[model samples]
Target chain A: MHWQLEIVFFIVLITTAFIALDVKNLLVAVVTLSVFSFISALLYIVMGAVDVGFTEAVVGGGVSGILFIVLIFKTSRRSSD
Target chain B: MTRKDNNPIVSLLSRIVSPFIMLFALYVIFHGHYSPGGGFQGGTMLAAAVLLIRLAAGREISQLQFKKSWGTPVGSVGVFIYFFTGFLALLMGGNYLDYSFLPLGLEAPVTRGWGILSIEIGVGLAVMGILVAIYDDLLEGEPND
Candidate 1:
């Protein structure tokens, strides 16, 4: 119910998304993506779904990070596009 | 002798900090039920520690250092652990996730707490694995560090 926390979370979420988008380096973008995930998880906590939010942070931010890194290793690091 | 004996903080603290990080991670995992923190949070924290090692020790630290394969497995494994606990409860003939259903002990709240704890551990492993996986993948993708 605390409005300030909600505002802060929103700002963080937006910033994360922007960072993920703006960063040229794929790795930097990926790290930004994690930041986004963490912010959303915080939102979930505010919404009273602490457990669900926790899961999201873990999976979206954590495991997904690992997957991205692996895929990067398998593929080319340079953005040919 | 020179390289190994670099800055005082980074040198002496290096050995101490990593273990402490690891221990704190475990502590967070076990204390999830009674605390505000839980599996995912703890897991990410754990991964951060590894990332720190990677940053400080450079890539050559460990050959078996959770490169990639660990990611997907950890994710699914966490879910598996969660469901498995529920299944065990179901087999015992109590409603899904019903603590009394488990044969371990009939203590109401404790049984439930235990279930959540197991799930948290799984979640911690999964989340931590994923964070590193993502970082490695993303960084690896970049042209250069």
Candidate 2:
């Protein structure tokens, strides 16, 4: 059961990373990065690194997400093609 | 890009929720020794709560909660606090950050615990201040007027 969960999380994490990189819209990419952070946090928790997991969840998902959105507001949203 | 609006529901909800988040962050900071949380985690949480308000209500209004100018100074104070603790230990003829020589006349372990707590508090303050300062600086270059 544990290994299955880990495998699923790993797969999702990789998927999110690729999506974050591949997405042309900066806003969507930022959101996908937030998803990646969340998955990484979950993986940390499952591995028993609770403190690390908490930091990843809060800093990665919460704070960075806000910062990125704020940046998008300040700059252009669409990537230069 | 969508023009940012001060939505009523967002402002109202954020006002109510931010205080709770701050309270929880404090809990995490102090309870770190017995729990998984510590200064960095709690401090980031504090920043998150404050940023939520800034994002929802606009910077001018959020200034009432925490002024824009206070971020860097507050962070410096935190670092000073951490350093001061070590300096205190040094004044007592111990090595820097040597908890056993803290001025309090307590058992060695207890003194260490107190020292650790103080350090954690300092770290929390520093982290909180720095994060907020970074956010403020990031937005500063843009002409808001």
Top lDDT prediction, candidate number? 2
Q: Which ten residues in a row have the lowest lDDT in candidate 1 chain B?
A: B1-10
**Interface RMSD for each of the candidates:** 6.8, 1.4
What is candidate 2's CAPRI-style docking category based on DockQ? medium
lDDT score for residue B1 of model 2: 16
Can you give the DockQ of every candidate in the order shown? 0.14, 0.75
TM-score against truth, every candidate: 0.58, 0.93
Per-residue lDDT for B124 in model 1? 84
Candidate 1 per-residue lDDT over residues B11-77, each given as its tens digit: 3565568677778778889999887678877887788677656545445443345555566677788
lDDT of predicted model 1: 0.73
lDDT of 2 by residue, B55-133 (tens): 8887778899999999998899989989999999999999999999999999999999999899889999999999999
Worst 10 residues of 2 chain B by lDDT: B1-10
* Candidate 1 lDDT by residue in tens digits, A1-81: 789999989998998898889887888888888889988998998999887787787667765775565555556655577
